[model samples]
Target: MVPGLPLKNTQASTGDTFEAAVLAGLSRRPRAIPAKFLYDAQGSALFDAICELPEYYLTRTEITILRDRAPEIAALAGPGRQLIEFGSGSSVKTRLLLDSLEAVAAYVPIDISGEHLEATSRRLRADYPALAIVPVCADYTDLPMLPWLPGSSGAAKLGFFPGSTIGNLDPDEALAFLRNARRLLGPGGALVLGADLKKDPGMLHAAYNDSAGVTAAFSLNLLARMNRELGASFDLEGFAHEAFYNPAAGRIEIYIRSLRPQSVRIAGQRFFFDAGERVHTEYSYKYDLADMDALAVPAGFVRTQTWTDPGRLFSVNYFVAT
Candidate 1:
């Protein structure tokens, strides 16, 4: 359980703002909510289940690539550097990197979930007794400025951002995020990024709308979160998960469609919806190799290398300051 923090009353700034914006956006048309909100405690658990679904190939494919290339990545990255992971949820795929990077001096995992971070960090420290685990309880986007390392004359710091989470942001936002990271990492640092590549609509659709219903449950968990945290009276059965890949947009759009006319109150406001209405929940933008370069180029970084799985379902890209 989350200690010292009230998970029952906890709320995320981005998730809260995005939810209201999405609710308003739905008034104009059927829409999807941002995927970030799905990280609440319950949503996070459901996503863990999604990773096990056969149709959800993203996690497995990325893990395979990481395992296959971790040695090479570790060798090229050298030793005694800080390994900071953004959105370090569960640290499921992170073990590969930690195990491969024998030269790492310290491991820093940052996330919005203080409870989750502390728990994962504690477990990692226990499992990897040799590693120094410095867990930071904060949002990845606004992580506090890091202190300079002791006895190091500006050594390179590596940034590990896996799980295709970059797809959560739009192009400009992605670029800005890269810039922000550049500022935090300074020169000579590197960024290892994972991204989903554009693929067939059938595969994309199946990945987000798995047969096991894990994805649907993950999508709906956001409502349950709101009900618990924001005093929301949402009828979970009145909303259904809907997901599809837009080929032209090169994105996956996930939404919760209303099953019947309903009225719900959240944060003291009443929201009414007609049958068949929907709220935009998430847009996961896919990227090609070139598009990934475009995102990093203007942010003062140059793509160093990219590793792809056999099916090209996912990419692990390495970038360095230009």
Candidate 2:
């Protein structure tokens, strides 16, 4: 079981804010909610399941690259650096870097899901007893600053942002995030970023529209979350999960569409939906080396090295803040 925030408490703690967000999102045209809210304990568990599905090649492919290139990555990052991960999740891929880095100063895993972060931190502490482990619970994108790494004033900071989570942000938001990250990492710091490469649209569609329907469940859970936390009367049966690759946009667009006309009440406000009306859920953008450079350069990072799998399905890049 995940530690720290319990399900009931998680719901309670985020209730007011979530209610406000839900109301605001519904108030807007072409309704949408931030993707970060999708990772409640239950949703996080579902996503872990999605990663294991046969069609989901991203997780396994990235892991293979990390496994093969960790030593080389460590060499680039050098010795006694403080490691920080954004959207740390289970911190599964971190093991490769932790084992390879020489005399690491500390490990900090920042995540929005308190339960997930706490549980992962506990396991990591047990496994790597000597290393300092600090887990910060916050939305990494909006986080103002990180906690100070004790006794490591002069140590380099290496940011680990695997899993292509950066792709969820729009281009402007992504550039802003990269800029914020550059400031946080400071001079002499480095980042290891994972990006999904553009590929056959059929393969991309298959990845999101999995055969087992786990992705569908994941997308629909947003509604269930509202019902539980925001006193929203959302009929799960009324909506259907839809996802497809938008090649022109170079991203996967996900949404929950109303199967039929329906009215839902939340926080004493009723909203009507027309048949087939949709609420945007998330976007996963694919990037090539040039696109990566475009993003990193203006953010004050210079790409030092990049590693990709045999198929070039994904890229792991090392960038230094200048």
Candidate 3:
């Protein structure tokens, strides 16, 4: 059955052209582009393959932490609250949250990819027939206002932000995101966030640059997306995927470096790059407990509890709305 407006996932703008969106994003960061764009239907499928690669330990580590501590986190979430998730790509880690928060009446998954989001939501709805599924095909950074959960008279909300997607945002952007979340959640809501912590550079580099070459494929797929959607001529073979942890920057930078001097034309825009020059694709920032808490507190949240893997490679933090 189609959900009512109050329960339906709100889409900000479905008709917005993806090509125009990508171009504007490229202009914003001449050195890098948002990896979120790489999740076009095919790109999203490729990324699922990437997470399964043995070298990518972030997914595994986070899953372990969630599975072991979800019950406790759910208890903290309380009962009969709406579950709102941002950047809900695939939402694999969400199972732990939902399983723990059995009192939740709704599940909202927000994503930039319409096709992928719809498909995943449909499957999830089938599996969890008891829960209301609201999949929003909109950018998480600019989510539209949503209604309160059923059976609640403006009761408090619970936000589930899993997968350490927070690492993608820089310090300032991360702070802004936290502030925005705080505002949307209001005073009584709670936020459960997964964060990737600082770790060894070698481990970080390997997770991004895997042996099966899936990560490389995931990075290059952005160009493939452009070529297909924007009538651009990007020689996917002329570039190599390069990713490494920049310790100085406290982040992992993924770039598609030109194998040799190359000129790529996109949507009638011509750009030239010298040999070894690269177009940055993503930055996965790693933070410590103190750094994350410092960013969270000013945003009107007080850390309630944190669950981490034995290795301390990732942490799931529960914050009460202030």
Candidate number with greatest TM-score: 2
lDDT of 1 by residue, 1-322 (tens): 1112112212346456646854665455544555666786667677778888999899999999999999988887888677878888889888998888766766677776666667776778778876656676555765547543444435578899998989988788788888888887777788999999998889898999888888888888888888887778999989999988888879998888899999998777777888988787778899999999888999988998999987888999999877
Give the TM-score ranking, best first: 2, 3, 1
What is the Å distance of residue 314 in model 2 from its true position? 0.6
Candidate 2 C-alpha lDDT tens digits along 114-140: 888788888888888788887887778
Q: Quickly count the clashes in candidate 2.
A: 0
Best by lDDT, which number?
Answer: 2
Score candidate 1 by lDDT. 0.79
> Which structure is stronger by lDDT: 1 or 2?
2
Q: Write the per-residue lDDT of candidate 3 for residues 209-250, one digit (tens) a residue.
A: 899899899889988888888887889989899998989989
Q: Looking at model 1, which ten-residue stretch has the lowest summed lDDT? A: 1-10
lDDT (CA) for every model shown?
0.79, 0.88, 0.80
Candidate 2, run of 10 with poorest lDDT: 1-10
Error of 1 at 138 (Å): 2.4
